[model samples]
Target chain A: MADKVLVFSRFAKSMLARFAEKFELLETGGKPANEVFSAAELADVRALLTMGAQPLGRETLDALPSLGAIVCYGTGYDGVDLDAAAERKIAIGNSPAANASAVADLAMTLLLGLMRRLLPADAYLRGGGWSGARPSPLLRPPRGLTNARVGVYGMGEIGRKIAARVAAFETDVAYHSRSRHDVPYRYVGSLGELVEWCDVLLIAVRAGPDTERIIDAAMLKRLGADGVLVNISRGSVIDQPALIAALADKTIAGAGLDVFEREPYAPDALSEFPNVVLTPHIGGHTLEAHVAMQDCVIANLAAFFAGKPLPYLVKR
Target chain B: MADKVLVFSRFAKSMLARFAEKFELLETGGKPANEVFSAAELADVRALLTMGAQPLGRETLDALPSLGAIVCYGTGYDGVDLDAAAERKIAIGNSPAANASAVADLAMTLLLGLMRRLLPADAYLRGGGWSGARPSPLLRPPRGLTNARVGVYGMGEIGRKIAARVAAFETDVAYHSRSRHDVPYRYVGSLGELVEWCDVLLIAVRAGPDTERIIDAAMLKRLGADGVLVNISRGSVIDQPALIAALADKTIAGAGLDVFEREPYAPDALSEFPNVVLTPHIGGHTLEAHVAMQDCVIANLAAFFAGKPLPYLVKR
Candidate 1:
């Protein structure tokens, strides 16, 4: 008999197959939290495997009386209330570095795509219009990363990886965090200052309540016209109305948004600008990343049953 | 006492303004062939400014008795037969290396835009749809330059610059050229084999009767599945009808096209594909590039007029 697991995750079927051999997997294919509650009416599950799509809240903990631990899929455990988990003395594990490369890749994708007006050219061609031949004269060589100031907010796994990629382009990489550390790049004391300094400001911080709407109109105005705003974090980090206004007024050169506030409901104003490059929120949904995350869930469960240290436990 | 310039060309006000301060400018925006034929009707004129857009054929050339040298603004001087100029010892010069970087940058823009599916996401968002939160699964990262086998068909200056850029991405760059000299990249013997070996085949060769339709139905098929095509050169280099069929049948992953056989007259089939990233013939239109080309023309003419060696001359 293997360790019984509760997998409350939503991913491609290909990712689910990674864990089939290891444990007695009880899975939900991206079902809502309420459905998971109904299904786990009384199942004595050893652990729960959860990711971004499913948040393991206090209610979820209350429902799962026999839950040994909650294995967080990606680096972000924003959905899981750590204080609540500490109160219960339940173990919480997460995979942080597993998807760092994937997220960094996505962030770069957004930065380049938005800055270069990638989508507008496509629209011009597909709409049977020959207008793309005559682009605005303002366009220059896709802004060589060399000698440009690039600011990264949040010096965590994704941010560090992004910094590494930025360095490859010969960019002057800088960051802003709680305290300044001795990194190769400049460590700004304040987020607002970093915004003012960087030609391109990339937000890779967490998307929790504390970080919600952190990049509002004031912060955006600080960036002004010379800046390009790229948001690869959660939608809540930016104020949508402010962003729309900034982009429309050319307060900033352009914006590349992969996530938005009230997702699946984009702002009407953003649609009008050709300068913005928008993508569905898929920062860590690459094939390699999804499989790695799923595999992480399986590894955590195996370690828990073996009475060993969890691979990546979130100690609140 | 002022320098007299014989303007036998159609000129934009922008170009005229650039040279107006220093030279005694003559503005013949569009004088006909027959009018230019009667050069005896004109007064003192020293320089002839010619463009392909207007007729400066044998009769017009012969009639311009007072013209000492012709300064053409474009890179291609197919209109004025150099033999006629050489016989009379009339110096001729055109802009060179003016737009290489700009064109190269545009090529990369198209390449990134097409491979990343930028337009589809934009279309969805602009059509009152939300795509950023729940992204369509990403295709490969344009087969990252790090490990890609890139084939360059024309190893000229633009091609060499492209090769250097691809090399920066850490790709194994190869090329097919006529009687290749020593270069850093591996030179493949044949275009057919180069297409087969490359994950992406780039065309940077010239477009003339000699190289017309070099990439036809059979050549595209050789690229096979998962391969891509990018044409920054003339559209006459590729068979449009064959390319349409290849793309329709998914013979290759996609293509990024900048030039066409006919300007502003791209086939509907090529532009319609979601996989294709199409741009009008504005590859070499960057401000920096245009100024550089103008400078190059000035330098070339300055050398010829000063009885010094010309920096770059077309070997005809």
Candidate 2:
């Protein structure tokens, strides 16, 4: 009999099909695992698959007496209580850097979309504003990408990728991170300095306690009226109300956001602004990224089942 | 005394303010020269300024007897009758490469926006589809830029710039042009071969007699169901009706079009497709590009007025 893997998060059936082929899956449909499965059924579950952002605490870990591995489906493993898991001798694994390129691609997409005023331009063309030759303030010439200052907040895989992509457009790239890495772009000592120095600030920092609400109103105001903000990082990196106020008062020129303060939920106040480009949290949602992540997930699960260390075991 | 310069196109007052300061302006507001100014008023119009896409044929040339120079405000000079001007010993000038970077930037913007399904993604977020956990087929994983085959249909400044931009995304870049240049990208023999070979075909070929309607139904069909087409070049290069049919039948996955068959007007049939991203001809409409082109225009006009060769004269 195959070792059963409990599904701790809601996932599309297609996404979960691969895991089903390799292991017996206990589908909880994002409900309490203990409620869905009897103690007898749960006692044999040795591994669990989850979305990295979904909460996996000590309480949930204790429920699965036999659970020895916690496999995060994406690069982020923020919600997993690492201390709790480690105390129980449960190994943690995550698909790191699998979605970096896709997320970086999205960061570029949103950045370009916002900077070029794509939404207004498309609407002007579609709404007969172009044909009627009506005055469109939004269609006016924008600050082109050539030689523009693009500062990246974070020097991680996604940030490095974003810097590389922007550099190709003839923009000068710089970054601010917790620590300096070997990269071509110039590094700024502080986030505030990076925001003040560049015309566009792209946030690709890892989400954690140190980064939560780091980009507050003061930082946004430092970004100035001509500056634009783009966030592919977690929404907690920015203060939602501060960003809204910044947009309202033109403290910053525009914003391109893939992640929001809340997943799948952005207020009308933010979306109502013509200068803001809003997207559902889909920074890592690409066919290539998904396949790459699944490969990591499969590899870790396979190794764990064979009485070996998880190939992609997370190091604290 | 300032030399009389006829403005043969409709332009914003702000755009023409600098020109007005240097010349005695004869604003025709894109009206016929004969209608706007009497022959006496037109006689001393030694130089003319025009939008590159507006037609300035033999009839218009004959009306301005002393029109020694025709300075185009942008890169293209297709609208001017070059042969007619040559026959009359009139010099032609254009701001060559002034808008190349801007146009290239917009091309990337459109391509990224289309392939990433930005419109549908934005709509899904705003329409509460995301919060509702509604199945968003449009938001499904897309084939990202990484390692994707990208074929450039032109090898001009704009095309070369585009190739450089996409290459940074880790895509395999190739090109098909009239003659192979010393570009870093691999060269393909023909447009058809390029279409069949690459996942995305970007049209950047210049508009001329031999190149008109080159990308027809057959070419689009060769691009295949998964292929995407992005045209930043003139609309005459693609058969608009054929493109419509191809889209209707799903011959191509999607398209990002900046120029169209008609100026300031697109057919409802073309605009109705969700897969297509349309922008009014604003590829070269950036402030930086405009300023650069204006500088070229000023230089050409100043040279002509001083009885010297146009500094930025057209070679042919």
Candidate 3:
């Protein structure tokens, strides 16, 4: 019999068909394992394929007696219980760097959109405000990206890509990571310092317990009246309430957000502000990134089934 | 007496006040010369400082008998009658390269915005589409800019700036200019060849008698269904009806337009298409560009009065 594998989330049907050739795929159809699969159905499962934010905890691991590996479809694996899998000697592999360019592109999109006030400007034009009196002053003139200081909060793959792209705009690029890398950009020690130094602060840090609410009211306050905040990382990295308050009080000039603390539920207050540009969490939702991520996931699963070392194993 | 100068258009009050120190300015308030000023008021006008597209013809030149110089506030001077100015030996100066960076920045904004489907995505998220059943696929997955071929229609200052910026995104850049420059990108002689070679065709050529309606139906059809078109140059550079038909028929994938043949009025047909991103002609509407343009205008006017060569004189 083929090695039984459980799919915890929906994937491309074509990709699943390819996987089916080598494995007896047991799909949960985006339902909970307990709700969709009985103990008997999960008992023979040798490996599990899941998405970045799919809940895979100790209880689910304990139920899957024969499961040896867990492969996540995207870079982020925050929802997976790393310690639980580690204790069981189960391999944890995630698709990393696959979505870097797409996320970086989104970061730039948000930054440029906010800086140019694209939303309000488009609205004004579409609403016939341009043909009316005082057309020149219909929208506030944008601040030029040329020579503007841009600070990347975390100099990871995505952040570095953003810095590289911003450099082409003739902007001054600086970054703040945990430690310094060999990159040419100026290194700031802390987030507060980065905030103070930059006209725009781009958040690209990894999310975890340590980074939860790292960018709070204090940092937002330091960002000042002319500063713009752009968050393409996990929403948990920022205190949403603090950001809302800051935007409400005009503490910062504006923001461009792709993530929210509550997924699919952007705050009504945020929508009310003309200075803010908001999008659903879609930083890495490009066709290229999706294909790359799926390929990475397949590679990791294949490697594990062949008793080879996982390609992108998460260190416990 | 201070040199009497007829202001053809309304300028910033601060700029007008600065000009007031040197010239006895007669303001027209953006009205017709005959309606705003008598022929007597224009008789002593020593120099004319106007915007690029202001209607200045042989008739207007005939009325301003003392007009020795014409200073355009922006780079484009298509509306000015150069032959008439040449016949009368009137010097013409324009603020060239003042808004290059700003225009290039907007071009990138439009390109990225269209590729990412930012407008509809934002609307979807704001309109509670995210809260619906399928949130992830709310917008069509965008193609990555990395390694994508970008063909620039013109290799001028703004176009070159755009190419430089696109390079940072890891895109392959090429150009189609009347004459090839010593730039790093490959040069395609014809617009058809350039369209076929690129995934995105960016139009940045100057609008003139020679270049009018350059991007017509056939050129767009050559761009193919997967190709995107971005226009940050003059609207007259494109045949609007052809573009609208191409968009309606899905001959091209999408478009990001900042200019239209008709000023301040986008066609009703364009608003119906979700694939296109539209903005009023605001590519150079930045605080930095505005200040630079005004300063350039001032410098040109100052040089003409000082009887030195105009800083940015256009060859008649």
Candidate 4:
């Protein structure tokens, strides 16, 4: 008999087939973890495969008495109860750096979009504003990205990729991280200094207790009236209320946001702001990123089942 | 007394002030050229400064008997009758490559926006599509720009800048030009071959009698269903009707367009297409580009008055 594995979230069809080859795959289809499987179904489950910010806590882990491992499909594993899993000796593995390129691409997309006033410009042209009797300055003239100073927060894989791409545009690249790495980009020791130095500040930090609301009122003020903010990391990194206030008051020039503090619910105030560009949390939603993440998850699961070290093991 | 120069187009205030230092500046304010000045005004006009696709034929040249030179503000001068100017011994100068960076930036913005499905994605989230009971795949997943082959239709200054930028993303860049220039990018001799070789085709050629409607039905077919087309050059280079049909039928995956055949009029057919990203003719409309172009115009005019070799002379 195959070792029973509970799929707690949706996986691509190809990934599902691969999972089935190694285990008796039981799918939750995004059902609550405890509700999806009865006591009898949970009794033999050896592992759980999940995606996104699904809450996996002590209660769900207690239900699966035989559960030896939990594998997350994407880089972020903030929702998982790491301490509980650590105490239970149930190893947690996440697909690390799987969608770095996709996220970095999005950072550039949002930056360029905001710089070009893409949303308003497209709307103006489509609404026949361009054919008016007089030329309307409906679309404000854009500032060029070339030779502008770009400061990246959290100099991780995604941030580095963004820096690399912007350098080709002749833009000066800088970064601020917990610790400086060996990369050639100028390293500012603090986020405040980075904000003051850059015309555009791109956020790419990982979300956690330490990082929550790190970009608060003070940081926005430092960014000043001409600075633009682009966030591809978790929305929790920014104080949404502070950001909204700053945008409204023109304390900062504009923003391009992909993630929100409340998922699927961007505030009406943010949507109403003409200078801000908003997209649903899709920074890493490319076909390439999806496939790579799925493959990463499979590799982790295969390694764990074979009693080999997990390739992307999450340490508590 | 200052030498009298006819300002046939509206110029930036800075440029106008500079022109005033050397000449008695006569402003047209975008009026019909014939109506803007009487026979008295035309007789003493020693030079003319104009912009855009303004028609300058034998009639205008004949009227301005004292017109020693004509300086165009931007690169495209197809509307100016070179033969008429040559016959009259009139020197023609243009601001060659003044706005190349701005145009290249917009080309990338459009390409990135289209590939990432930025338009529909922004709409979906703003319309609260993400709050639905199940995720709607309203926006198609994008293919990665990294490692993709990008074929530039013209290897001019703007095209080369785009290639340089994309190279940092790990994208392979190639081009099709009338003659192969000394560049690192592979040059394909024919447009058909370039279309076949690339996943993304960028149109950046100059529009002329020889190049009008260069991209037609057959070229679109050769681009195939998976390809994307980006045009930042002149709209006259594309057969608009053919492009519309191909976009509607998915003959090409999608397009990112900044120019159209008709000046300020984009068809309702294009505005209604979900896959295409349309912007008005603002490819080089950045503040930096505007300032640089104004300076270029001033330099050309100054060079002519000083009797130096024309800085950016256009030969017939």
Report i-RMS for every model: 4.5, 1.1, 1.7, 1.8
**What tens-digit string does per-residue lDDT give for candidate 1 at A1-316?**
8777777776555555667677777776656545754635435776877775345778877767777788887877777877777777778888867777667766776776665455655556556566444443333434433357899998877888777665654468899976676567789989999999999998888777878898999999989897898888788889889889898888888888878887667777787777788776657765556666766777777889898778877755
Query: Which digits, one per residue and each the tens of the lDDT, describe model 4 over residues A158-267?
Result: 88888888887778999999999989899999889999889999999988899999999999999999899999988899999999999999999999999999887898
Task: Tell me the deviation in Å of residue B287 in model 2.
Answer: 1.4
**Total clashes in model 4, counting residue pairs 3 or more apart in sequence or in different chains:** 0
Question: In candidate 1, which residue pairs clash?
Answer: A279-B132, A280-B131, A280-B132, A280-B133, A281-B132, A281-B133, B98-B293
DockQ of 3: 0.67
Best by TM-score: 2
Candidate 2: the clashing residue pairs are none
Instruction: Order the numbered candidates by TM-score, best leading.
Output: 2, 3, 4, 1
The CAPRI class of candidate 1 is: acceptable
DockQ leaderboard ranking = 2, 3, 4, 1
Which digits, one per residue and each the tens of the lDDT, describe model 1 over residues B1-316?
4455666676556656656665666666667634653455443455666653233566656766655567776565555766777776677776765566556556666655655566775666667655443444343323433357889888876777667655554367899987595789998999999999998888888666677899988899999877888888888889988888999999988999987776557888887787888776656654555576667656755665566655656666
What are the RMSDs of all candidates, in order?
A: 4.7, 1.2, 2.1, 2.3
Task: Return the TM-score for candidate 1, rounded to 2 decimals.
Answer: 0.81
Sorted on lDDT, highest at the top, how do the candidates line up?
2, 3, 4, 1
Error of 3 at B163 (Å): 0.3
**Over the stretch B1-316, how does candidate 4's per-residue lDDT look in tens digits?**
8767788876556557656877788888866656888888789787798875677788888888888888887777776898889988888888778888888888989998988888777777777777653465544467978678999988888888888887777688999999998889998989999998899999999888888998999999999998999999888899999999999999999998999888778888888887788888788888788777778777877777887767888876
Tens digits of lDDT, candidate 2, A1-316: 8778999998878788788999999999989988898988988789999998888999998889889999999899988998999999999999999999999999989999988888888878778888888888554688888989999999888998999999999999999998988999898998889998999999999998899999999999999999999999888899999999999999999999998777767888987898888888888888898999999999999999999999898999
Give the winner by DockQ: 1 or 3.
3
DockQ of 1: 0.28
All models: lDDT?
0.71, 0.90, 0.85, 0.84
True contacts kept of each: 0.29, 0.76, 0.65, 0.68
